[model samples]
Target: MDTSRLLRTTTTVIAAAGLLLTGCTTGGSGKLQTAASSAQPSPDPTALRPYYEQKLTWRECGVPGFQCSTMKAPLDYANPGSGQDVDIAVSRRVATGPGKKLGSLVVNPGGPGGSGIGYLQAYAGIGYPAPVRARYDMVSFDPRGVQRSSPVECLTGPEMDKYTQVDQTPDDAAERAELVAAFKEFAAGCRARSERVLPHVSTVDAARDMDLLRGVLGDEKLNYVGASYGTFLGATYADLFPGRVGRLVLDGAMDPARPSLDLNRDQTAGFDTAFTSFAKDCAKQPDCPLGNGSPEEVGERLKDFFRKLDAQPVASGDPARPLGEALATTGVIAALYDESAWPQLREALRSAMNGDGAGLLALADSYYERGADGKYANLMFANAAVNCLDQPPAFSGPDAVDSALPSFEKASPVFGAGLAWAALNCAYWPVKATGTAKELVAKGAPPIVVVGTTRDPATPYRWAQALAGQLDSGTLLTYDGDGHTAYGRGSDCIDSAINRYLLEGKPPQDGTKC
Candidate 1:
């Protein structure tokens, strides 16, 4: 159970791959228009000139058409002369064009820990709508402390395997203590291994890094598509450099004004909403594991199953790692990210109930990005680093979580207790938060499109509504559907609207619903 406010975008990729076997703020006018000329000089301090002017020598790397490069940014933006710098890993696929080429369209798939370069090379660069790709260069970068960009390392694979197995929904003081200790151990590992990069991995810093990338890419304005936590990153960029904003799309948006606890609670409710949807769907399926019942009954049964696991673990295929409540819950949450994964989740649940925990364990491993070799990706490590630095802990201690458990449970009867406890992980972070909840108006930016799916489990639809209302020029586009994000998920309505905006600079009408 990861404690981050937003799930990594890669979760969808992982979930889909597993199933393959089985299954922001307004300003200005409400209407989007062509961005101001890129020829206009930036208002950034002169101290950053070198970073802004640095050239990227891209060379072929991963896939056929994609190129990878390293970008340099100051480790500490306030002290560019500190001698310490971070190299941001970047990738791009130049426009395959017949039409006039638009500027680069930077994308972030939102892990704060997620590998933007990996996402670019894997999907966005090659899989995006070709018409849009024909006009704009598809670009992305690993944010500082992510992947090749001075990644934050925490536990070893064995250590992480043990950490994930720690019981998230503690039943007593001893269990609670164990959970806290696990969080402390994780944080200590990060401090010990990644101290140099840990303190500098805040979203604000990443947003500034985007500006540097923009200048290096020779774009006067930053055109972008940011999903999940990437939405927050995009919103931060717009807030910091509204003058440079161009055709920005924040899908599966986060409300910047929500405090950490509220965000957690809301997200808890979101998962419950998604689970209810899943339960309803499962009830209709012949092989539904929980059996036919109301969504509420289904949730209760699932909780009962978790309690059973809490008492006695199940055998997973890996002898070293048995399936427990934590991993099983994570597995369920991972499947909830995509409705298409429902069938997979159904089968996994059935298998888990039948004593074979491999299916659920596999889902959990995917969520954690654990390779078959048992090596875990840096996604979770960077996730905690950035999330802890971005906002204060949702709860200060176990007692706080206990007190708030009722609210969380009220929000989500099934996922609440575990998620509430999971939220406590940030309380032990080695670095204090450098940011806080606040509205991002991006006052001078042109119209930016904010898309929200009605049943997004990780990012609630209300957040999109709040963010759109907060932005002075925000235009809200709604997909009355399920899943984590709306775009690129088979919704022609959502895709066309975003494509039109990217290619023609005309945002969907404000409050448009598809």
Candidate 2:
């Protein structure tokens, strides 16, 4: 786990508690139950009827090809008849086809907080394969507490700027105290500002909202393509409504079986793996900033650079802001997301090493989505709120983190300590966790395709394997490549496989290697 991965929430819906189970035992049958089976009413389905039967009013959105709408879901599903309602923002581009339309294909990007509406308009809606786009309406929604939804707002732009610069790899008592204070202030801000919405934005709650969206759209089943954390959310929906699944693709899948601590640790290791790959590639390039050396040597050099920044910050060409260790590490982590960003990262590093930190600072700011006017988006705030409520904190405080430092360091000597400290952000959360880690067998569902990139830095490949194994109807598709995800990233094998599943309802065979 890097600092971003710690604070950022990926979209997934595994119960936070009692997350472990031996194997998939859903419905006692491996195959999907009848579609009619999903219609079986609950003992108290009356409370949900209003939500399930409500009509949607879609209108022209700002984007030329997209339509937008608002729908309401119970703030608390357990008490839908009594609690307040939260608004959901949805966007869609109807299929433009020369063939019969299959249905709506809902797409989600990783941040549990990533705006699905934005993803729909900017990427999946127009950028998806032409055949698939022509046959399936591309759809997306802002999950609760995400942008355009009932978003969770916390620190202001200035406040967030200060928060991001706080020394994560504290070297002394004073620095540690400052880091602790920053975390406390951030946690307190979220509590003060978003109390009502904080407790209800759990992944489980979002999954339930998806169910209502399904009904509102008049779809008998859901067709979805979710990446990174989105995989978790899609799987959770399947777990909650197994009979309503159709053509589900979970790319960069997460293991619902692991606890938060293990997830963080494994993610720490995953980043190390990705960085090593980056380093290996860099060594082959003449302009490598860390020098053309062995991976271990390069790791040491980068660590040394971070250590130097810890003692004395460098000018980033911004009078009020100087490049610090935390910001530099964020810049590094941002590049790990995509190999295409490698050249930019190299330039950023070269600039940083030459006493000019502007490039690196810019990269870090981009990762945090800070604007030129000092305004920050609600992405990080919502990410922390949802992640904290989804699982128990990895550590309670600095003391607990100190005790576990060795394990983390062993996981990734370069990024270990900073990630461990970042994990503490959830410890002081205002709301108690509403869910826990739990197996999502999603039994009695149609075959779900689980895709994994071998060198993905965020969700590890083993997690995809575990998730596939846990889901009774899961089929594993492996992409032996680098980067955070496989599909739609210059991989014909992956795109063809996933596209076929969505357009033709034909999932590729398990263990399909690309």
Candidate 3:
């Protein structure tokens, strides 16, 4: 994840009892049902004890070519009939020309903060192979505290701009004080704006919310594909609802067994791996601007450039938008996540070295989701709130942060320090984390496919390996590419396997690497 556009991934472990809240539904995670029951009236809330709660009614809303509606759930499932309610937003793409559609297939793009509905509309809706989309009604939901289904808001645009620009990796007491003050201000803003919702948006709560979506969608079991942070969300679902599992896919996975500190450090190293790839590729190109040298030399040069920019921002041709260290580092981080953008990165760097930052700025803008009118989306705020609520920050204090700097710098000297600082956003979060680092053992659960890309800078390939090792029935699929995720990144072998599984219930053999 990067600054300005997103912070830490919102997905985290289950919280303590106080911060953790159940979804307003009728079933508990321990056991839902082996399979779908006969089509009948929804379960009675009063009939179920502390576990299951309210019955859901599917209705219609307007979205053209798709069905849209809200599922009424308890604001807190632990107490249903208490006159409190929360709305869950859902959208479904009905199965195309039939084969007696198998069931609903839910997809998440993994921001914990990613817009599930928006991802469906953009890539998964139509870009997914035809055979898969044929037998399954592609569905996506905005989890609690997400975009459509009631969001969490904090700082204003101007305030946010200042927060984003704050020096995270400070060198002196003054700089450290400045950093702490910025964190406090950010925390206070979130506390003031989203006091009640802050404690209730952990990943476990969101995972429970998914089970409700599955039940409401009328699916016998969960059929899902979650990427990046979505992997954490999917695993959490399995840990809680293993019995209700169906065909689930977790691509570009994260290691649930690792703590926030390790997670952030690993991600820092992941970026280093990505930049090494870019450096090697750049050195081979005739148009290389950052000098055609070894990867180490290339990295050092980038660090020098960043230092130069930090001291004196480049012209960038836009007086209103200076190309400072923050923006420059953000631009670099974006390229690390996906190799498809490597060529663009090289070009941007070429232009930047010539004192033109327009190209790099555009790349950074996309990752940040910045609009032209000097306005921004609510992504960053929600990202922090959800993540900070899930688990404690990787950096809790100055000493801990200082200790990790060397390792982070070792990963991608150009990017490590800034990312380490970015981790500080949640250090002063309004809500306390309810979850911790633990393995997700989906014992006796249905087959779950785990995909990894060797050069994925966001979620490392090893994460998929570890996740597959942890899950009782996880099938490993390797993309052998440079990108944040494997699916839809152009691989015939990968697409065909997923299509067969969705359309014919035939998953690729376990440990199949592309």
Winner of 1 and 2 under lDDT: 1
Would you estimate the TM-scores of all the predictions?
0.94, 0.92, 0.88
Q: What is the C-alpha local distance difference test score of each model?
A: 0.84, 0.81, 0.72
Tens-place lDDT digits, model 2, residues 1-514: 1263432222121100011111111111111222211212232456777777777766777677778888787887767778598888888889999799887888888676777876777677888899998998888888999877888999998888889889998888998898888988998999899989998898878888887788777788888988888898899889888989988999998887788888888889998998999999998998999999999999999999999998898999887779989999988987887888888889899989999999888877766767789886677888888788888888888999899889999989999999888888888888888667888888889899999889988899999999999999999999999888888889999999988888888999999999
Model 1: lDDT of residue 86: 84
Model 2, poorest ten-residue lDDT window? 14-23
Q: Write the per-residue lDDT of candidate 1 for residues 271-361, one digit (tens) a residue.
A: 9999999999999999999989999999999999998888988999998888889999999998898998899999999999989999999
C-alpha RMSD values across all candidates: 6.2, 7.2, 6.4
Off by over 4 Å in 1: 10-44
| Residue 499 miss distance in model 1 (angstroms) | 0.7
- Collision pairs in model 1: 25-471, 26-471, 26-472, 26-473, 26-474, 27-472, 27-473, 111-114
